[model samples]
Target: MNPLTAKRIAATGSAALKLLMPGLCFVVSSLAAAPVSEVAEQFDRHFEQQLVEHHIPGGVYAVIEGNQIVRVRGVGVRARGGDEPVDPYTVFRIASVSKTFAAGLAAVLAEQGYFSWNDPVVNYVPDFSFRSARYNKALQVEHLLAQTTGVIPNAYDNMIEANVLPDRILPHFRQLDPMCTPGECYGYQNVLFSLIEPIVQQTTQKDYATLMQELIFDPLQMATASVGMEPFMNSANKAMPHVRARGGWYQSTVVPSYYRFAPAAGVNASAMDLSHWVMAQLGHYPEVMPEHLLATITDKRVRTVRDLRRGHWRQFIRDAHYALGWRVYQFGDEELVYHGGWVRGFRADVAYSRDRQVGLVILLNAESNIVSELSTYFWSKVFDAIHIAEAEQFSELHSTEDD
Candidate 1:
């Protein structure tokens, strides 16, 4: 290394990252930021190779260590037909990854006494009728975000996909009987989960989007993040969605269906924005996302045994449960907090290991299961590194004691 550059790094008195600028150059805002470690470099190479083999037109992934973006890259073009290159700022529809934001907002409001988790959903949206009044009254604010309302899994999700407005679709809940009472069972729902929107709006007297922006996004400095379809469509650097067919990859227009449920699947972000989000969850931005709020939101509330059978995740995930917006997995002896999103033409996966102070976000324009495989591969290798380090430390300690 040159003396000038080495002197700069040494002066920082912290780990300096040497990022591989394939094409894009990201400026490290702080001198203390860590460089791309061997594992991070390997993960990036494996991910890019997979995207090429899978024909994923364009995507971006960011790796975060502590409060630093150690490594981030954009792979491929914005669309299959375009010459526009993707970048760390190329926004993609994060889909259900939006749930984490919703849950985070709820945690923040609840912490500030805007509302309590124990508050009933009926108190805010009295029109949220169900075939069973007992279950209707029993459903609380926590159940909406926790996926434990005991309603049928993905209840009315088809309707949402059919372009049915939530107002029209939600009333249909009264026709069906709930499988179990609130908090008794785990049943994922885009419509039911989004009920948190009305509850928060009513409690805070602010629109859901504004609340998310003021409370979470702005505080974390997620500059490229925005909510709903209009903002995504308006953004000039957004990654247009894509669909894979037998012939090749094809571009697809972003549908307005899922955007109607803003809390469930309606947020746009770039890899850079998500790096800040990861840092907040890792206890870096405590003023915005305090450790208590993180704990409350990620606290396992319902067992999701079905997660153990997921395509690429089944083997590594020994146990699985749904927290408010996140899924907690027992990967060997470690805890993996994760969430994955799939909307029409996009797929996103975000996972972080708090113990290791590491996080990763993968955003893609195509609807492929590669996101899952890539994330699973990453966590597996991360855990492997942890094991090696611990073993080495143990051996060195014993050797010293013997001497």
Candidate 2:
């Protein structure tokens, strides 16, 4: 062989000899496996690169499919000026993610005949009278969850400022003054849902958080999930909220609300725990779930919001509706149930498609709208990967068909 050709042959021969050796056989075997480490590296790149681009303080994410946690990672810091890095154990204020829990608790009660979807609001809380008599009686549990109660948007900002408990604000339905007749238009009302917290507690004789623990978290073994205020604040694994202001990120301190409103936004949990919650929602593990309750939670009651942003022809959220807590969307043939939350300096998004057996949870401390798009992109990427994997799997299973 020529000198260059001889050198190439020698190198190849040495590499093959090493691979054939007893110790190196293990390395070869690992290499031949499905490249799990490489997959993890790529997944981390996708998460960390997005955080760096968005200036998100730091956050955690988990991907679950078919009752398995395929990926769990934390990127960035615990807070803006903190030296601590986030970990799998880091807890985040799950914001409207709590809404799902609230809605679930409501479902549990509804299944027991505590309340019905079509039940009048005035029946549960006599003080829930609206300015218009027709709207008052027309307002139902379904309407509250559907965001079609003719309430103004974010009407609870001043409510929180006033230190008013949700029950105290029930009488203020008349103050909303019917922006549109009940069921005629959709406008989200955080305070209205918060009111349901007391109703759930009163009807079930169990606190909202406790009911969630028994019905959802405990059953799913989500040990790190909680709606407690003091416990989360004092937990060693918890991350502090961060908000961008004055051209830099600042640590956010917890602000007290009038009453513990675990309904609208109060739960805190890590990504691993959330992935378990998502997997339960997917219904792959049926024994751990209450079938009727799951049906109640996932079933769409009304198409409340028309999702005006996407336009009519391509409106994936066109038939968008709300069950108890989830905002339901249809993408082509897939039905996606999702929720995004923001409170103080925390933001979170959890979305999963029931048809695809795909679930994604992203929790970040930085206050930004970019989290929503990042979360949606992650879900799409995961589903796309699943589709490809399934296609390859089928092709392998039928490889001899053509022969």
Q: Best candidate per lDDT, number?
A: 1
Q: Residue 381 in candidate 2 has what lDDT?
A: 43
- The alpha-carbon deviation from the true structure for residue 372 of candidate 2, after best TM-score superposition, in angstroms, is 2.2
- Whole-model lDDT, candidate 1? 0.84
Per-residue lDDT over 246-317 for candidate 1, one digit per residue giving the tens place of the 0 to 100 score: 767899888999999999999899999999999999999999988888999999999999987788776555
Q: Model 1: runs farther than 4 Å from truth?
A: 1-36, 385-403
TM for candidate 2 is: 0.78
lDDT of 2: 0.69
- What's the lDDT for all of these models? 0.84, 0.69
Single out the weakest 10-residue window by summed lDDT for candidate 2: 24-33
Q: Compose the digit string of candidate 2's lDDT tens values, residues 109-199.
A: 7777987878877777777776767677877777776666777777766877576766676667676676877666767777777767767
Highest TM-score scorer: 1
